[model samples]
Target: MIQGAGTVILWSATIERQADRPLAEVWDNLDAVWRRFNDHEWLSGKAHGHAHRVDGYARHTALTVNEQGWHPHFHTLLVVSRNMPREQAVRLAADIAARWVDAAEHVGVVASTEGQRIGLPAVALPTDSPHQARRQAHREAVARVQYASHQAWGHPGSIAGTPEGVFRAAAAGDADALDLWHEIEEATHSHRLRSVGGIFRTPAAPRR
Candidate 1:
């Protein structure tokens, strides 16, 4: 059974100078920044697992590029377990923002929200759904994939595999799979991944 729902803490920061750099470069930089935030001691304590016991935590980072010339900042979504209180979660998120803002002069922390709210479509639950039936089935599927993928790859598996990794994995022989993956990835990149209570919620409502 799932213990708790997940919450996403979204964050962003702007850069002053618009460097004519590839999107990959900007993504790498943003990943590095969040990695540092995740590795901090005080923040790690709030993480879910044992690996987060010290200065490291298992958190996912999504990087988005605003080509609309919206300051060239990044949108970050940090997944936290649902059991955490809102105030505590917000406080921890704020700590991360402060550190990132201080690390780079041009990068100033932007707004932070509890979950991904815009662009992505909402998932509709069946009106007559039986209690625990839908959630249980979803949890089982998620556990299976998480276990299998983690064993296959050294890293812990995301509830849904990373869109980039999924796309690359499927691009060789399945054009259809590639196209489908691309669409989902693009949506996630634009809207940010939202988390529902269970693990296997649709990509539209990712677990953070």
Candidate 2:
């Protein structure tokens, strides 16, 4: 994420789960998408979960829900041990999107259109500062917070439910909001918000 961190490569790509696969549907059946992704070896990884040794080829992947017009696509950020070729990166993103489409079809939901189009993959992007990557992360966090805050969205439980207003307050130098964010962030936490895999994920870690 810094100017130079040869040990890690940060990149991002957004792919939709197909129009037919609505967030509501995925929300209702979390397994429909998450489970299959977990089982599939779309990426070359010998390990799963985050407990793997840091030296292993670990990737931290987060799922984002875009409450857009008709389709609610997912945004993913991948931090891999090696810098993947742009072509392969695009393919990986495309393949994941296809997998989601297949998951929907498996559930008897057919999309009218093809799977989501793969956006150009950003490779070796800087994330430590005010780069696009950082902005994207903020947007994802904000969206996750918004989606979870409104229970009407039907999210099972919010892992990112810490009031975003508190974040803003904290940024404004409000010590109370900063303290509250830390308290709620720990208390409201549940499951892992992101998926970790690839050789970077050590096999020694407990299986999910």
Candidate 3:
């Protein structure tokens, strides 16, 4: 967390799992939507009709394939400019989720706004200062992102559950999983898995 940072949130987006599109095509569309959402001016800062609140962000994207085709999405850690109440943070999450949905639709990707989740800062103790509260929130945000990344591959000790299951099956010579793995490699080659944006691009930005 940086100075004045507040309201950490976790946001996610993924395409329709059952879409019949080829893996490469589906990945391309999802990638396009992500780029669109990232570059949207409305999300850069304060907008014409709404306050975007966000000042910096870090994103981590993952791609996994299973029986449902390709599943690719990013988990973002958003740092707002100031501390906000939980209700306000929830509203902000919804607003950002709606924009993400719009970006996906514009790129011909079917996405669910329901998956655009948010996690607020931890409750501060009566004696904690504003900076302490923000630091606590950042810690929670990092933990949530880590949890989300692992949960995507299913719970521990479940070898048959995906998206980890796909790889396990492929190793065991499962024909479908093998094919999906091939496509996954082709689609993800040379693509970036992490990104930093806005004030995070500055040298002064904190990295933790």
Q: Top model by TM-score, which number? A: 3
Residue runs of model 2 more than 4 Å from their true location after superposition? 1-26, 45-74, 109-195, 198-208
Predicted model with the maximum lDDT: 3
TM-scores of the models, in the order given? 0.34, 0.37, 0.71
The count of backbone overlaps in candidate 3 is 0
Model 3 regions lying over 4 Å from their true place? 1-5, 46-50, 121-163, 202-208
lDDT per residue as tens, model 1, 1-208: 1124433333444333335544344444444444454453344454444321222122233332223311234533233333345565556655555656554433332323322221111112221345456445434444443443344335624523444555665766667556546555554464423323223333365566
Residue by residue across 28-127, what tens digits does model 2's lDDT show?
3443454555453544443543321122222223333223312223333344433445555555556656766666556554432244433332223334
Q: How accurate locally, in lDDT, is each candidate?
A: 0.40, 0.41, 0.65
Full candidate order by lDDT, most accurate first: 3, 2, 1
